[model samples]
Target: MHWTIPLTEPSLGAEEVDAVVRVLQRGWLTTGPVTEEFETAFARKMRVKHAIAVSNCTAALHLAHLLCGVSAGDEVICPDLSFVASAAAGRYNGATIRLAGVVSQDDLTISPKAIESLLTHRTKAIVVMHYAGFPCRMEEILAIARRNGLRVIEDCAHAPFAWTRIGHQAEFAGAIGDVGCFSFFGNKNMTTGEGGMLTTNDDDMARRARLLRSHGMTVPSFDRHKGHASGYDVVEVGYNYRLDEIRSAIGLCQLAKIDQLNEGRRQVSAWYREALQGLEEIQVPFLDRPLEQSSCHLMPVLVHGSYPEIKQQLANSGVQVSQHYQPISSFTAFGSGAAHSPFGPWCLLSLPLSPQMSREQVRYVTDCLREVLAQKQLV
Candidate 1:
């Protein structure tokens, strides 16, 4: 079942294909020089001292938790509105997860006040996810961390090139905290098929994360292959979370033009806002947000009436849509049993969004949405 306009799609092309082919021709598939090159390029663009490429964002978060010394009986405060991996990463390190509510219905980022309220003797760190590419209020959140001596791990899956003002200067999403984790999944602003990046300004943490990324070895196989070392040593216990050369090469290509691609997403978002205006039953979040500051990773709207019926009707009209998430706390694994906000899974709908989306497509989606609401007498 194909929709006239899909929710999201990667803007892959000849460059990505050529990069993969070059990697295959080089005969080095695992983490190698190409991976290092990708890491360097990413770190430079992100304005971070170090960037360690990993298998996925979950792996990056897990590494961040381990490096921050999150362990059994400790608690990590995370956004209840984000993807489950935001909380699951801490659980992997044996840390208890403390759910933090969002700022409000209009701004879905983790609330700084909620984070402060959740702090306890066992609290070790705060994980803030920039919801839908909109940067979280980092200044207040960082102040909270400083006063509590807690680590701040930024989940930047939705915010690759996104930035915000901290003091008088602008800072990138992943570079503002103690450790920043990023995603390069297929649907993300950038794509590497399945990969992520861990960034930090702390030199010691960067060194440790690099060592821990590939089984805590004194020297990786790439160095050995190049005759840099005859033997290697395992210094610390680590997991096999290395990004392959093929994906790394692809990431290089994606990173080069991510800003342009993000601009296209912003345009689509603008069209959506224009087309969605005057609909009483529909409320678009981040209406005041400027496009330059965000990557515009998602286009979610809060429906005042029957969301399920609206969604089904839109689908029937050949429009594909999605939900950014159901609050992580609502999952049975987390055992919260309910959503944290009134704008929960059933009320929030992510409309079709992509760099390739055209104004006509956006108008069509909104037209269908208007029809659906009118049919249900929601507006």
Candidate 2:
């Protein structure tokens, strides 16, 4: 079934097209000048000392855990309400993945108090996911980490440009933690087709991450190409998680227009709130959070007791909806048990949200949802 309104669509235009064309015409691909430029631009935007581009956000997370000294016998705390990558990255580094509960039904982000309760001697880091591009309660979370001597790695896949205030200063989402990981997958606020970036303020960690991102080489291929270095030596064991020049080109273009794209998403979210207001069956989360700004990557609603049926009904009406995630603990590999929180697997619905969507399309989706709920007598 073709969706009249899809869950998300990348905001691509002539700038992205031209950037890709330029990279292709240059003939040199792989991690080269374009990738370096993209990393530089991203680093500047986040106000971080370094931004290391990688294959995807998962790679960024894995590398961050390693840099943070998470290893065997160590435990990492992550929200149950996020993509599995948040927890799985710690597991990749031989750390035990401990689950942390969300704040509440109204705010699907990790609770700082829950994180504090879960911390033990073995806890090495806390991985915080900014669900739906809403900034997590970082000020409180940071205080917790400081008191416990644990590192913090932000899973900022949904929050490319989102910010929150700490006292009188504002900080970007990815830059707020010790290490921030981002995704540029097709459905994100910005797209590089498939790419990721890691941001950090520590000089030594940045150097280590740069080396680890490309086979732990002393010199990168691009540097060698420019004759800045004659040969390279492997200093440490690392993975081949480098982002190519083509995707880097796309990232640079997307970064330039990210604010505009995010604003469009915000407008659509506003339209959703106004149109869906007074519908008792649907609960919109994060309407009252006091963030300086959000990237608005998704628009999710909790449909009281009407999930798969409502989903199918919307599909039949030519609208596409998605579940943002099933709690990490619900997976068989992680032990198929319910998450500690009430907002567990399959209860939430992510509506169509994208920069390309218009107010008319949003209204149409709400109308379809209202009809579906009435048919089921859910409203």
Candidate 3:
């Protein structure tokens, strides 16, 4: 079925097309000068010392876990509501996953107190997802991590430029932790078709990430292309997770307009909040958090009951909706059980939101949703 209002659309314009064309014409398609430039620009925008481009956010997380020394038998605490990548990264390094719960019904982010409760002597790292681009309680989470001597890997795939205040200073989401992983998939706030970046301020960690991203090579393909090195050596076993020049060029273009795109999403979300008001059965997340600046990547509403029926009704009306995630603990591979989080997986509904969507579309979607819920009440 064709959706009258889809979940998201990438805000790609002439600039992105032209950038990709230029990269194609240059013929240096692999990780080359353009990729380097993209990494530099991303690092500057993120206010981090180094940014390493990779194939996707999952690869970035895998590299981060590897660099952070998440070995077999080590426990990594993660939120139950996040994408599986958050836990899978640790599992890739042979670590055991200890799932933590979200804050409460109103806030969907991972709770610092929940993380503290799950902490043990074997806990080596905490993978925190900034769910729906809302910044987590970072100061509290950071303090907890510090007290326990645990590394913090921020899964910032949903939050490109989201930030929070630590005292009087503002800190970007990806830059605040020991390592930050970002995604540029088609549905994200920005798009490179498929790509990701790993960021960190620690020099040693950054260097190791760069080395591990490519086959633990002493030299990168770009360096060889530039005649900086004639040969290379495999310093250690690594994975091929490099982002290509075409995607890099597209990423650069997207980075230039990210703020404008995010602001557009904010406007759409504001419209949603106002239009959704006084709906007794629906609850909006992150309405009370004033200090954190969200990237507004998604607009997820919690429905009290009959979620599946409501979702199908919306789909029948030619509106495409989505669920942000199923609880990681509920998966068959992970074993069927209740999620550790207070926010159950079945209640949340992701509405249509994108920078490319117009105000008329937003109004139409909300109008249809309101009509659907009202009709359901009548029955």
| Maximum-lDDT candidate | 1
- At residue 108, give the lDDT of candidate 3: 88
lDDT of 2 at 77: 94
lDDT of 2 by residue, 1-379 (tens): 5789989988898998898999999998999989989999999988999999999999999999999999999999999888988999999888988888789888888999899899899999999999999989999999999998999999999999999998899899998999999999989999998999999999999999999999999999888888899999999999999999999999998999998898898889989999999988888999896433889998989986546787898999999998878789888777566544255432699999998788999999999988987887744
How would you encode candidate 1's per-residue C-alpha lDDT over 1-379 as one tens digit per residue? 9878888989999999999999899898999999999999999999999999999999999999998999999999999888999999999989999988888888889999999899999999999999999999999999999999999999999999899999999999999999999999998999998999999999999999988988899899989999989998999998899999999999999999898999999999999988988878888888888878999999999986555677788889999877778888788899667654456443888998999988888989998888887777743
**True-vs-predicted CA distance for residue 263, candidate 1, Å:** 0.6
In the order shown, the candidates' Cα RMSDs to the true structure are: 1.5, 1.8, 1.7
Task: Quote model 3's TM-score.
Answer: 0.96
TM-score of each: 0.97, 0.96, 0.96
Task: Please tell me which model should have the higher lDDT, number 1 or number 2.
Answer: 1
- lDDT preference between candidates 2 and 3, better one: 2
lDDT of 3: 0.89
Could you give candidate 3's per-residue lDDT for residues 1-379 as a string of tens digits? 6889999988989999999999888888999889999999999988899999999999999999998889999999998888988989999989989888889877889999889889999999999999999988999999998998999999999999999998889999999989999999999998898999999999999999989989999999878888999999999899999999999999999999999999988888888888888888688888886523889999998875556787898999889998878789887656476543245443788999997787888889988988887886788
Q: After superposition, how far is residue 272 of candidate 2 from its true place, in Å?
A: 0.5
lDDT of each: 0.91, 0.90, 0.89
For model 2, the run of ten residues with the poorest summed lDDT: 337-346
